[model samples]
Target: MRTALNLRLFLAAVIATAVALVATAVVLNFLFRLYFEDRLRDELETYLIQLSGNVAVTDSGEVEVGPLADPRFNNPLSGYYWQIEVAGADPVLSPSFWGAPMALERPEQPGVIRVQDINIGTEEPLAVAHWVILTGQDAAQRSLHLAVALDRTDLDVSVAGFRLNSTLWLAVLGAFLLIASAVQIRLGLRPLEKVRSEVNRVSRSPAGRLSDDYPTEVLPLVEEVNQLLDTNAATLERVRAGAGNLAHGLKTPLTILHGVERKLRKAGQDLLADELQTEIASIEHIVERELARHRDSGQSRQVCEVAPVVRRLSDALSQQPGSEQIRWSVEVDERLRAPFDEFDLTELVGNLLDNAMKWTDGRIVVRGALSGTVASLTVCDDGPGLSDAGHEIVLGRGRKADPERSGTGLGLSIADEMAQAHGCALTLDRSDMGGLSVMLAWEQAEAAPR
Candidate 1:
């Protein structure tokens, strides 16, 4: 499914943050439990030492345990206890002793002790004993020792209270962090949101463009897009203005010619009337060609495929009159696609070829070849070539190079404008066919070539 860019970015940040937090919590929780358990073990081991110090052998050889001095150690219900004993007699238990004297299988060995949910009387479900035997003493006189059981019912209760309180506090912190993450995501993405809102108001119709000032990160993109829109708008506006101006400017002369033709018809001079009609038709043709010039002024410089346009033009030209009589050739690599519209590029090449065909009395050769950074086109005609003045006037507005040099006077001008729009130029010179060889030298950028 398609998602908003900002939303996806926000969600990705949230997920990554959450994963990091969970990983940290797990690691820290394990460490806390490990350290806390160690502390509890150390406290139990310290109690074992305190109890041992109170034990002594009497003169009659009976061992006696003195009353524990610490108030907490004396309380049976406090969940802590100890046992003192000398070998061979019933083990001495504290008055607080609430369990059976231990029957340890390993005889009070020292190290890790494992005992589970053993009952210690008074309805206690949890009790544990840490027993150790003092070595290097006589067999009859060795101290059989123990660090007595914790009520653990109370220890468990304390553990439950501690874990509950810690969890509640951690939950509150986690909630705050989640809310903060949402706010942070919204705050971080504000600039891009502003860009979207700005773009929403722009339109291509009235040549509208984006104008919002984005953050430094997005500013370049916004600026480039706006520039492209502006360039396209300017080009389209120029074409519209040029069309309006050309229509108004060329119509006046045609109107005058029409009036002159009417005058000649009313005067009834039949011989001269035919000549005037032909001249008027010729002028009308020129006016149409000038309109073509204005129409061809727009060149769209988006990604355009050159091969398709060439193929389309080749097909179109084949259908034209006397198309088979001339040798037509098109050469382009598969990657040499035109950057202009298929129709626009086609119209440019087609017009140039049509003009060449008109002037070529014999063989006409048209070919487009590319070499590295430059693409060149040659439309050679075995017909009368252009004179010195033809070069200047061909590119000038509405003026023919040679008044006597044939065809609708606007063809050369249309050809020149098309060439410039397509990023090429027309050069007038002699052909090997003893006619005009118009060499078009176009430099295609390593970037998109129009």
Candidate 2:
């Protein structure tokens, strides 16, 4: 649910650090308390031994204990309290003990010293322990226990005070850390923000470009986009210029020719009428050819399924003159597709098969193959195919092998040019159908936008 990228990462790190700090504090407090208790118990044991050494039995069966010369060691008000219990019929002890019973955990358990909570006096909460020892008086062995305690009320108050200040500091530090992290997030994303702004700027019109001012990571997309724009621009310019030149070249000549014809008619000369008609026919052919070229060039290459084109072209060829007389057949993998413009596809196949129908009387065959990023289209006919000279001339620009040949005759040349433009090639070979074979191969581009 947390949408900020840097904040999420920073918070995760901070939480982890806080958890580690709490764990460390707990471990250190445990160790520190343990060391402190051990030192306290050691002092208590030393005091018990000193008090026991002061005990005297003067061989009169009279027992006497401390009223020592060590003034510093005699104070019970030093937050150090003790209870020496000497086992006897009625052993008397210090009246300094006022309230709160010292709890000896696991009764009769004796050792160096240990810490425990005890009731020492009214409103008094003391951490206490006892040290037990044996005394030898002739044949009598007497047990004595020295109980020492400290008032923990003051220490608890100091610890609680320290905790209060630490909590406030932790809150201030956490706020400062969050603020710094937010600033860092903004700084880190600044470059991406600039890229977004530039993108917005470029989106206004077709003249836009991905700018060169970008991080290295974004350069490839910029370069590919620029290449596409440049290529499209060049193509558009070429098309515009070609259209203008074609209009001027064709329309002006036709207009002048019309004027000359008008003058001839006005002069009453029927002499060169047939020649004039032939010139008009020639002009019409040029006009139709260029028009077809313009239409075909505008047909962009696209990823088109090849089987359908083959079927369509084959069926059309079957309806052509002398086509049904020749058996027709098509073989193409149904899944195969090609990078082809619709007009080029028609022009390419139509030319090859039309030329084939010229002589093929038995059968015509069409095959479409897809292989390793390349599409190969084969069109073959069984008629008496092209002569070596005729075959070469058939595909040449505006050149018909026999001067007697008819038709606009730009089919093969146009197919070649279209193939080149689409990053494909054309090949000629002998068909197994016993005629000339023509193959068109091209690399198809993907339809998806990068």
Candidate 3:
């Protein structure tokens, strides 16, 4: 449903060019027909002048026509003919006429020549020039009608050939115009393409900004976009500062409550102390989850190698108390890179590995690979995995599959939130290692030197 600007412009240019060429062809055809017909009429008039000069009247009153030089006039039905008529005498005809006179309307006045189209029993019409002349003096004076004609089919054939040639050339011109229009549209829109690339660069890096080296027409848009990026960057800094202040303000009270819970336990008030502990833990989980979300929200997306982060997390976790007895299998390509903030990737992978270290049965597998533009990171363990329904429940805050586990159930929830923030999908499935498999996949960014 979305139309491209280049396509729209090209289509408009095509329609306009087609219309102009068609109109030109029509006008040219009409003008050429008139021109060719005018030339034919002039030729006929020339013949009529020659015939007038050669005409004579004898004393006995018989009309005589001297021989003319044109050979076409001597051939019968040759589409050329001449005729001379004297009052009260038989008409003088050319050999081409075959004794058939053209039905021509004579000029009303002597010495006046008129030209018109007339049919003379031929397939095509004839262009005839007729002249009425007075010969002799006094009582011997007589009116002479002189006429000459040529077949209209000759003129029609010439015009038709002109039309064909003109149309072919016009079509060639139209094609050239269309190609030129397409190139113009592409060159004209190149600035917008540059703007899009610059915008993408800004999104992928915290400090990237649009440059001013652009055309005059596109400069204003570039300036506005750079200003907007500056504004958003300022706003994000303020939001991060606010989140930090909120965390500090809330943490102090939670710390004091922890001390108070210890006092109540020393006084043997076990029930009240337990209740306070539960509330304190709940508040702590909420604070941590919210703080993580805030951090992820302000993080700029960039490409980072997946193997280094995975291996670093694995090494750090391996030194932990329980993980010392477990085997960590890391199989990630060094070149596999995805659009993710380093801190976000660390937090997400760290949580998944920590969770696996908790329930994993002495063996864990971490794998990262790139498939086309998508990069996938999978962390699997030999620990007992969750059922299909429990998969969804564990992703909720504070909801652990086994309530008896000695930790707050915020790990998977925070990892899931971070994955979603980075436009990645976190899925839980049964691992081949007989435990939970947490896979995070996202579209990879353009390749960059590490």
Q: Which stretch of 10 consecutive residues in model 3 shows the poorest summed lDDT?
A: 296-305
Report every candidate's CA lDDT. Answer: 0.63, 0.64, 0.85
Candidate 1 ranges with C-alpha deviation above 4 Å = 24-28, 58-61, 85-87, 105-140, 204-209, 238-450
Ranked by TM-score, the better of candidates 1 and 2 is 1
TM-score versus the correct structure, for each prediction: 0.49, 0.43, 0.84
lDDT of 3 by residue, 1-450 (tens): 999999999999999999999999999999999888788878888888888888888888888888877889989889888888776666778988874676666678888879888777644588888989998999989899998888888788888999999999999999999999999999999999999988887877767899999999999999999998899778867877887899899878988997898899999998999899788878877887887777766564765667888988888889877567899899997778756766677878899998998998899999987777788999999988989999998898777898668667889998888788778899999999789999998887554444
lDDT of 2 by residue, 1-450 (tens): 557766676777578657755665566556655666667666656766666677654444345677634454345455656565655524334444444445454337554555577655476767776666666665766666666566677656655565565556666766777667667767766666776665554532335676787668766766776787678657856875786678678887777776776578678875675457457646655654565466445344444566777788778877877556787778887766565544456666777777777757678888876666666888887755667777677676656554444554566766766667556788777788677888988764332222
- Clashing residue pairs in candidate 1, if any? 306-337, 306-338
Displacement of residue 64 (Cα, Å) in model 3 is 2.5
Q: What lDDT is obtained when candidate 2 is compared to the true structure?
A: 0.64
How big is the positional error of residue 70 in model 3, measured in Å on the Cα after superposition? 3.2
lDDT of 1 by residue, 287-360 (tens): 65665555554443433555566667666876788667766556644455443555456666676666777776
Against the true structure, whose TM-score is highest?
3
Error of 1 at 127 (Å): 6.8
List CA RMSD, all candidates: 15.8, 16.5, 3.6
